[model samples]
Target: MRPVDEHVAHAVSLMAPVDLDEVALAEAFGRVLARTVTARYDSPRFDNSAMDGYAVRAAEVTVGTRMRVAADIPAGSGEPPALHSGTCARIMTGAPVPHGADAVIPVEHTDAATAEVTFYQSAVTGAHIRRAGEDARAGDAVVAAGQLLGAWQLSAAASAGHATVAVRRRPVVAVLATGDELVDPGMEPGPGQIVDSNSTLLSMLVTAVGGVPVVLPRCPDRPGAVAAALAGVDADLIVTAGGASVGAYDPVKADLAGHGVEFFAVAMQPGKPQGLGTVNGIPIACLPGNPVSVAVTFHVVVGPMLRALLGAVEPKVLAAPAAEGWKCPAGRAQFVPAVVESDGSVRPATGGGSRSHLVASLAAGRVLAVVPAEVEQVYAGDTVGIMTSILENMG
Candidate 1:
């Protein structure tokens, strides 16, 4: 059996990075940036007022001083005339301060007037003024490469004068769930048959990792059904659930064995049966049949592959103390569907342990508590490594 880390590294090596495309900022949300974005101009662009007030010379303004409002400067107006010795400019928030003016007294600090304004408070130098390049200067790196373009990042890119950003194209993933005993969801199952929820699960997982999932039709456990279902399909990666084990009716192994897919028994509990290879230039990953196994394998293997295609960094694993004890598989690493409590401790999401077939209990899991193969059991207060979904914690 192959080690889990070796299998994951091998699986990720099979995928190539997706091509980059220049997309409009409106459509760049959730996309990974392909290049570093630089500022075309300074942030705030010029010296502007941070508040709606009068732009004045600091040394000229005093308490109870009455100055004539020589000009009204609203936001978006062009350069205004310079401030005279005994006069000030009525400047609104975000409006550029007039030339020769070094301070701004907020409107609330003075009597609200249009033609003639009286200052009840003295003005301080450099007060309430947003200086040019204060946040960022021209040509400065605003957003670095490989950063996911969220609302905040996109806004910064826009403020850097970018109408469109170069981003990695989302990888197209074809999800195939193969099993003779499977039926479409929402249909009543007959004897010896079950609902096919793996397709939905895998598709959602692919999408959550920033990949576009193309859910293929269910392939049966027939001689050439797996090959026939994936023939001429257009996708960067192919993910197949079920039929990866050593069962007699495992069609994914039976059909794609000689055609580029190499099956393996990974050293991990709840997700040991795995396959990693490519089919006709497209990468393919065949996972175990159980729902929990699919969840675990996708997170450890397939999800990382998708992220790699998008030029994204891998998910982070945080170490936390175990809230309770749990037995682990003898020689296989354990990936228990677990939850992080409010106290920052980790525990199994269900009492049933890491049983692969425990589908219903998988929903309660928010993270995977990873244990090494040598660790026979996790005692309470023992430090354990927990892995979270990349998209779940992305902001």
Candidate 2:
């Protein structure tokens, strides 16, 4: 079997960007942009007021200097009136500063009247004024392609005069769980039965990574039933949670071989039995059956592949420092569920290790403290890698 890292590297090599489509800017949240967005017009458009005040020439706003009131310009109003010599106009916030005015004396600093307003303070050139194009110039690329759109990106598009954006289409993934002893939640299980959780977990994981998940029913341990379940699913990525191991009843390994599936296996704890292949040119990642094993493999293998399919240019795992001591068993890398404290501390959750099947530990983790095979002990203050929480910033 390939080392865990090498297996992931091979899986990543097969990834490619999905096709693109234009979606309304309002509907673009959580989607990756397929094209660059440029500014249609200069931000601020023209010089405007930053405060409700009297717009006047900075040379004219001396103490006790009185200037004739020209015209009032409120925000969102029509064209402003030009300021005559020794004159000022009543300007509200965001109103365009009229020609011949280089400064704004706040209304609070001036006495109001039709004839003239008395200034209580001196004014400087360009005071309280927003310069045209200060935020962005016209035709400038504001948002680059491949950026995942969020509220800020949508607002930027709206500010740039774009009502919609071209984004990569979400990839479709199919999930199947194999085991005759497994049953769906709420089913009364016979003596050897267990609840089927891999399907649900895989579905949620696929959705979290921006893929559409189609969960196929559990494939029984029997060969015929397993083969039937593997067929008839249309998906870009197919995931099966069990039957990849060397066990006699493990049928997924043989089933995929019969259907000509490729790519399989790696050396990793609680998840050594895994598969990755293509069925009819669609990518398939067959994860392991153990719940914790399923979670780890999905995040390590399928998660990055899905993002790659959505056009993430430099797809790679982001690591964080390990805040506490962690021991790694030799020969296989380990992914430990950890809570990344606000102060950068990583605490392993109550469940001890991979065999614990502590799915709750997965929920409690904001990061994963990865321990390499060669490392016997990860000490406090050591910088290990962390996988960021997918639920932290949902749109």
Provide the lDDT at 138 for model 2: 98
Best by lDDT: 1
Name the regions of candidate 1 deviating beyond 4 angstroms.
60-66, 115-122, 319-325, 343-346, 379-383, 390-395
lDDT of 1 by residue, 1-395 (tens): 79988999998899789999999999998888989999999997999999999999999999999989999999999888898888999999999999999999999999989898999999999999999999999999999998778999999999999999999999999999988899989999999999998998998888777789999999989989999999999999999999998999999999888789898999999889888899988999999989999999999899878878988877577899999999999889999988889999989999998899888767888889999999999999999989885446545
For model 2, the superposed segments whose C-alpha errors exceed 4 Å read 62-68, 105-121, 188-190, 262-270, 313-319, 351-356
Give the alpha-carbon lDDT of every model: 0.91, 0.80
Scored against the true structure, residue 202 in model 2 reaches a CA lDDT of: 88
How does model 2 fare in lDDT?
0.80
What is the lDDT, from 0 to 100, of the residue 312 in candidate 1? 84
Clashes of each: 0, 7
> Per-residue lDDT of 279-356 in model 2, one digit per residue for the tens?
767778887788878888887888778878888544345666665676766777778778877887787764475553
